[model samples]
Target: MQVLTIISGVVGIATSGTEVWHGIYTLPLPVMIVALLWTGARTREFFAER
Candidate 1:
C-alpha cells in the first residue's frame, strides 16, 4: 500500500505539468486520486486498530 502511494505520487507529479500547461486532465490524475484515497483509508484503519 505504501509503495502504491509512492508510485502514484510520482506519476501524479510527472503528469501534473501537462495538466497545468494544457488545462487538460489525464488518466493518471484519477489513478493518483484513488491511490491517495486508498492510502488515507488504510492509514485511518491502521490507527483505528490501536
Candidate 2:
C-alpha cells in the first residue's frame, strides 16, 4: 500500500507536465515521503506490537 501510494504519487506528479509544481500534485509527494520515513522508523515497533 505504501509503495503503491509512492508510485502513484510519482506518476501523478510526472504526468502533471506544466502543473507539476502546482500544489495539488506536489503536496502529497512530501507528505508521502514523510510517511515513508515514519513507517520505516516504526516498522520494528509496529510488527512487535502486532
Tell me the lDDT of model 1 at 46.
75
- Candidate 1 weakest ten by summed lDDT: 18-27
In angstroms, give how far residue 16 of model 2 lies from its true place.
Answer: 1.5
Cα-based lDDT for every prediction: 0.60, 0.66
RMSD of 1: 6.3
Which 10-residue window of candidate 2 scores lowest in summed lDDT?
A: 18-27
Best by TM-score: 2
Pairs of residues at least 3 apart in sequence or in different chains that clash in candidate 2:
none
For 1-50, candidate 1 gives per-residue lDDT tens digits of 54565465566667777545332234456567666776886768977855
In the order shown, the candidates' Cα RMSDs to the true structure are 6.3, 4.6
